[model samples]
Target: MFKSKEVEIPLRRSELISPTGIGALTTNSDGINLMPGALDMWFDNADIMENEFEIYEERLSKIFNVESFRLPPDYRAPFNKYQQAEKNLNIRIPMVRFPNWYYCSSCKTMSKEVSSRKDSILTCSHCKNNYARLIQVPLIVACEKGHLDDFPWNEWVHESLGPRCKGPLKLISTGGATLSSMKVKCTSCSGERSLRGLTTKDSEHLYDHLSKEGYYKCTGRKPWFGDRIQNEECSCIPQPILKNASNAYFSEVLNAIYLPPNRDAKIQKILDLLALPNIMENIELLKKTAPIPLIGTVLKTNFTSLSDIDNALLEDGIAKIINSEDKTENNENAVLLNLKIEEYDLLASNEKIESDFLVVQPEYDKDGNTLLHQKYGISKINLIPKLRETRVLYGFSRLNPPLPLSTNRKEIIENGKSKLFIKPQKFKWLPAYKVQGEGIYIEFDDNLLSEWESSIRNSSRVSKLNERLNNARQEGIGIKADVSPRYVMLHTLAHLFIQEIVLSCGYSSSSLKERIYVGPKENENMNGFLIYTSSGDSEGTMGGLVRLGEISSIESILEKAISKANWCSSDPVCNEIGMDFGQGRDFLNGAACHNCAYVSEISCEELNKYLDRGFVNIYDATDDFKSFFNYVETR
Candidate 1:
């Protein structure tokens, strides 16, 4: 079914499974059966990460949220010069290569690793059963260093034998609750061992052994690179991990809202004209010789002469065209992080401002009557007349969450990329897409946010989030310590607002996306969130969201969202729960459940975590310091 889905998916819809959800679904116990309309596709990590530099961690990989289109049809394909041009350009989705090992469910027999796919069912060699049901093995062992492999059943069963032995093995389970009840036995040596304490809470106790060795050492198994390590030996110990474990894999995707260098329409026209490979090569010659016949044909304009165009403007446009070859040329990380600040600067400028890739207009007249600031403590509301976003997925981690790109993550990502590729050279470029759309950006009052966060109740709330972060760190997940009370508040507010705006925004709750911006300190100073819609369609989202940015409409939405968060269907129990003890092991949420604050999974960037209605609205009647919106409600 996965193979068939790969063939049936169209070019535009290839994004449905390009970067994530490749190995997520399938028919049970039938690794190679057709389920009619099922679609299974994935992109090559090496291919996705390949570019002028092998710095997959630094650039050329991320999750692109495409909302509207700015470039022409032919220019939309970012991997135009790739060797696998047909796959990247026409279909856009590539077939996922699943593991070859499969197990028979009924007979409890296993088959050797397989490569051929002509038949869906294979006869069990041990049981001599034909058409036996086989499912892909869901167990994989991995280390924090990013090495992954199959479970070492033979090693555990025949502990007496050395690692090199090829002993026959059988899996046995007594239908018990704990893993100790499940046993693995070597038919050859007649040695057997229970799987007790094998799934240890800490990585230090990877394997439980009766002998003096205490725990089993990692064999440096890397299934992704075939069954061997070619160049170097791994230093990290491998831990047995279930393939379905949440910590097994975490995709690291980077996303940036497209920012243009300038907003001159004529210059933009010149840049688009030069994007055509045919015309770009001859741009230098065209710039020198104005009034060229070829320039008029390429532009297809009524205007006669290029002599009227300013020479300085022409040079500026030429530089932009050259830089467009790879937008990640100048400090890619800065390009990624600074775009928002650039956007903020632009919004603070004159109204009706237009740039090459973006435009902004205030929702109300200059200093017009608006209650967003007076009633809701919202500082400003700016309408995004147009925006472009680009996304890509470069590398991923398993068994432990990845550290941020700012930390030691660079070394981890580089090592991971080296494991995935044979020669590890840069390819032409990575896949990318651009979209155009309009939305609203709401900035909260900094002084008010500072005042609210300084309260003792808020300090305790932040500690709860830090506890989760510490737990992840102790588990070797390497998650960043960026979650503060401000982040949680903004994240929760965005979720509740998305829920309230769905009816009026004329888009499904899933179509609307939230981007939360909060700085680490007051000097870095950012406090705001944006709710917008993106799509491959031409007109974007029918302008419903932008219309709702009107002062009156926004005030109503904020009031309703805050009021609704006061009581969920699961309240009392939800409201009374302790901040440091509840679901998700670390209590990342409070008074927030699917009944009230939660929305579609696609609508949230944090997987719907790190939210609590207690931060936004009153949880208990007499609670003084819990809710920030109580300030507005009392007024």
Candidate 2:
């Protein structure tokens, strides 16, 4: 028997695209494991869906080939009984029951039951006249192809005894430490099996043993879609995994910093309106007529209040200017790089841009010195008081980090490279959320960085790290950037800076994230990184982080960071091993470990890879010239 009740689970808006996105599981306060329902099940009313939840990002919209993005519909409660107008607007993100199998400790009976979104309680009918509470089974099965299903309990217990034999199942556990002590039995015929070897390497042995007997296989179940949807056909082998395993879901989120369209307020508004779907085409078609009055008419029809339409009409060739400015590169990587280059150009210019994307160089100290440390080549520091970052949940994977099947969006969705939506054919908008925060941007002297990189470009240590990176890429480990001495130096410095600044910035290291921008090649030469607060709270907007950009505080922090990098608790072992055999995931890190150079994975763009403290300061006499800040004496 099942009981229905409405339950509220509090979730932050940013969490919807991470840790608990679509297809990811979260346990509610009542201990009911729930998975957020598919995008198709989000909202019921069409008007509320379109007008209230749309988010606009021109670069992301063009890259993803979608009209717009949508924020997860937030639930609003009606204030009073007379507030009938607000009642219909209240919306909630739908959830579905997962791992539907439940066991009753009081009755010793195992049952499988599917419940609706509103049902939060289930009881065992065999015990105390249906008063015994049912506990959800924590075991489930998934395949690399992103299919999830309840564990095959019946087949494992019977194991060729008889599929026709219908019997009630009992899950029993003997007091022991290993999984072999837990067994499932058919109460009618006494057929039984233990749950041993189900968690071995890749669960290959268990899959082989059961699959050979024609019992355990993938059913291609997508339970996130509600109960009526049929399972798709799939032939991949399924492996038993715990419901809360870390590899259960890996979200593929894309983030972009907002770049203003124009400096003029009205011009920016007109460009934003033009970025909407089919508006540019309408303008082009209307251009054949009177051009000014006709364009003003179209703009007035599309926008709610365009009092500046006359000004837009008076401008010469506005449509042509907008079109030329709106063009983006066809290649996806090129688009992303061009977008970053634009940001780099703005941040590195040292000019104060005072719009939504606000950035200003910190004033020089009382001594009229802008340079914090000449020996370390610290060239410029800028403070961002206001910035908007948009993050979109595009797709997710089950057993691995989501990889693209092809560059083509349609092909990537169709081949199941990543599960974009329940029925991807209907996917027009992705779920996204935005954050308003502040940051500190630090840029290095290009000439100094080039000179240091050239001094050790062909050294043995540098060659070994590059070789490992190339190997990792060949094995499809997804190392996106090419490793260089300059990149490693910048990356390590960013980590040290984050670790040091958290002590005085009033924000924890977890709330501060690093965005490294290092391009050593001639065509795309850049040397800088941004440390920003991404929490979207009062702490993120406070001026504590930006105030540290002052010359006195920055110089003190840099000295401490370099001093801290000179020695690690792991010492010689951490610094020496990677040069010979390698360290960290896929041997991607050198001279770095959790105790020294690692930060929260959310803070690091490279997942804490490609780091080496030796790049920052001299740890040994033999590596003197290799250090970027070799002029600094050892402690």
Candidate 3:
């Protein structure tokens, strides 16, 4: 038996695809568990259909094979001054009640309910005065396959009794900090069971410690899809988890930096026209009839006008498309590498691009010398005044992160393996949001990096790390990319640099994001990283980050970052543990810890894995040659 009510929680448009996205749990001011409904539910609103929330990123569109993306509709209050307020459109992301079990604070009466009205507070009817408020049960059940459901309170309390016994349940706490002190009781039969070992993971089967019969199994319940959507068939054994635990939901987000088209103006326009959903879907028919001329005709039909020059551009664009389709299909790793190469070429050139992507060298005083290159062997520095980043919420996993289906790094995104829409036939676009900001791009000298890598690649310390990374990959852990000494050095430096930038720049460490580019292949050889402001507000675009890219400021920033990496507050212990046994998640880190080289999860692209400050700092007197910046002291 359940009741229904409505509750409204405010969230930013960016948060809709992340922390509070579909299948993820969030709580409101009144401590009610709410989950955003599926994409199908968001589209049911009439206001969303009438308005334009479509976002276009050409590179990402081709990568994900989607025509476009839709941004979450921002809800405006009726009294707001915006245009949507006047119409009282009431556009909001739909949410469903989750962890349906709730308990009365005074009477300890447990009941289940749904959300359907504005006033969603549940009062205890069992209490004599009927004045007690109901609090949501903090525990829920989840499986690795991403199924979520309420804990089996009814079955647990009546474990000693048969399944036929039906009774009201009560959750009582005997005033202790452990789960053994909490017990669920059946009021009618007096049958009860302590919650001991309910959340433990030592058993071979999940929740097997609770009962020897192994009665618990996932119901395939997807609460975010609403009541009408039926539960899917699932055989995964569900495990008990706190409602707000970190392992509950791992959002698989695909991020891409906006790259301006590197083609002729008219040709780019033709390419854009070809990318339209209607045109792309019907490409095969057009190619069968007449590849170039028919495509030009279709473009004219959709875009309304085409001159002789436009027709010529259309012919070239269509020719390139046909050629690409005829070539052997490249895997996800190759596609991702090509995309990075394009960005690397543009940034390394230090030219000022005039589109959404803009990068220019910082101005310096006449007396200011190139200390960064002269002392640290750094090659180039570019200040990006305007940049756009597109983030798409493709899919998610529970218990463990979504793993790649193949050996290819980043292959989880290939073939729509992690697509957001469960039923592909119903939706064509993924949810995405674009943030505009400024950044500082730094590239190391290729020759210097190559020499250093070759010198240290065979060392025992570096080999140990490589073996651990390969083993993790073989075991199907989520360490997607192969770790080279170059990648580790760059990644460690990126973390330390962001930590120092937070002290000088106005933005916090979490507000800045790192994008590391280190390709092991010959043609795709890259050695650079971009530290950008990823905040969704004005704080990110206030020139604080870009200003640090200047010659006067960058030198001090790098010096402090490298100098700090030489020592950690956790010192001998941190370095010793990393050298002998590694540290961090899955022992993926070496000579790095929270005291020194760790940043916020959002800031690190690799989830803070494959980091070793020893590659950057001279941690040992005998291993001075291993440090990339060992020459810093002499300079």
Candidate 4:
């Protein structure tokens, strides 16, 4: 029987519960929490995992260069007593106390153990109060080396451990009620100290007793585990932080765009055969012995019988699907090239309508007046009425930004293991969320982009972006240096288009998201980005976005989008910002700000970094050296 029934909220795999949310849900709220369990548990708990989970795993792992991605169980509505199941995928995060010290509001008595019952009623033993109101201590100390512990209240009040007198501690709050006004006192030894000036603005001098020389060191407390007493080895100085502060814990999630394995009808047919359940093991045996009539009869059960093809032909198709392979390229370029080729072929097909594979149509004609294509160096424009995007949560890091490829994987991944099972030896899979939506794809002309990359200012822009990437790598932030003039230009274009489209289209700017394709000149170079809306709602697949891509409507969109990019509300100040040293997180950008180019944090692929309006169209009409689309004459 379950201990308690907590209200479960349904959220997409993409919309993950932040680390702080996970902690608060289990500790602060009266919700039923489950532990991480076996892979089979997800199948039992979630229907989506049981049916389509493996396909996503195979596709996503290749894209992200991961071993395997575990699918999170779909959260279901609360069950009735009779419908209760044996397994629940709802995870119970490790019980790490927020304020390590819990204070009784009535008696002002401070104790580490404030909650007396499983029902979470705070009872004070000092005042003989059965139900005492407890306030969580907001003060916490965390080191850069990923260690957390309670503030040194005992040592701070006494200033030293000289007398070895065990004393009862009480936190006294005065009229002022500021941090300095609140003082800690030892009721037995009569030792008292004010908590003023303990921390500076940077939190570097967290517990300096005298002149910043004498400071408290970290004890390296790891309370997330069951033992609750293990001290990890650390050398870094700990910084005092509030429990709810943004820096306390950061959730580092890695994401990938799902690309189909094959688009050819013949290849797809062969793949369909290989995908048959319990068929791979007996594939060879069936090829050698099974006759066409028997195969036809077997096919009748799951698919339409293929009578036209002979046994020899059928065997060759199956063999081809099994042996089909491509030369392995480096992880970084390979993913972009794959997406580029897929998008290129899809758009080049020039299909006006295809109802089966969601609404997607390319607006390209040999003689049609494609305004962006002819005038602005845009190669292709394709509208997607519906698409699906998957986001997965694998592991997280606390102080240091989690690097997916960094060799120091053990320290972070183990620490962020789903608070499901206690310390599993091997971690293979992670949870994923999927959302269906619509978008527009824009591909840039290759020759024009190549010319723009040669410009001095554009090269300078790329160098700064590379520097940011290198810094992120040195700090173990798990990012690759894949910046290019083509990338920056297209990214900026996507951002500007998003802003422009929101004004004309009914969709909100926040609802649209970007998927960029950029790679080296040696390979199949990609210079494009897709801006789409992916919502969990049923109305996400509306054809409004595709209509915007139509020839009649697109000419005006391009004209307006260019006009918007040419001049920002911030104007000279925005364009004049030097990008040589960089400005954002890693000094990765130039001439871009919130008033002109910034989109919602969720909508941007680069976290709103590596964007500059100056790269798209020249901020000043006279300067064309820095701009890719600057040479376009007014039509």
Q: Which stretches of candidate 3 lie over 4 Å from their true place?
A: 1-6, 47-51, 79-88, 115-118, 160-162, 177-180, 203-207, 261-327, 364-370, 404-419, 520-524, 536-540, 621-625, 631-635
RMSD of each: 11.1, 8.4, 8.0, 9.2
Clashes of each: 14, 0, 5, 7
Instruction: Compose the digit string of candidate 1's lDDT tens values, residues 1-635.
Output: 12222212222332422223222212333344111111111233333322221222122343122222111112135454564544224323332223454566666644555332435454456665554556555555677665555566666666632555565565667897556676766666777777766667742244545334456556565444433334246666677655556766555544566545544456776666556666565665554565434444443442334445544344445555543443553343434444444445444333455563444555476554355666777887777756655544334566655455544445544554454343344432233345456667888888877777775344555566567667666865444346767677788899989988888877888777777777632133678887777552575446788788777788789889988888888777775663646443244566677787777755666656778787787556443365677655454
Point out the higher-scoring one by lDDT: 1 or 2.
Answer: 2
- Weakest ten-residue segment in model 4 by summed lDDT: 31-40
lDDT, model 1, position 245: 65
Candidate 4: how many backbone clashes? 7
lDDT, model 2, position 11:
79
Write down the TM-score of every candidate.
Answer: 0.68, 0.83, 0.84, 0.71
lDDT of each: 0.55, 0.74, 0.75, 0.57
**lDDT (tens digit, per residue) of candidate 4 on 328-366:** 443444444544445444443344434423435554565
Candidate 3: how large is its RMSD? 8.0
Best by TM-score: 3
Q: Model 3, 216-324: lDDT tens per residue?
A: 7789988887777678888888988889988899777777887776534556677776777776766767776675666667767665534444554566566657656
The digit string of per-residue lDDT tens for model 2 on 3-32 reads: 657745677778898768988888888898
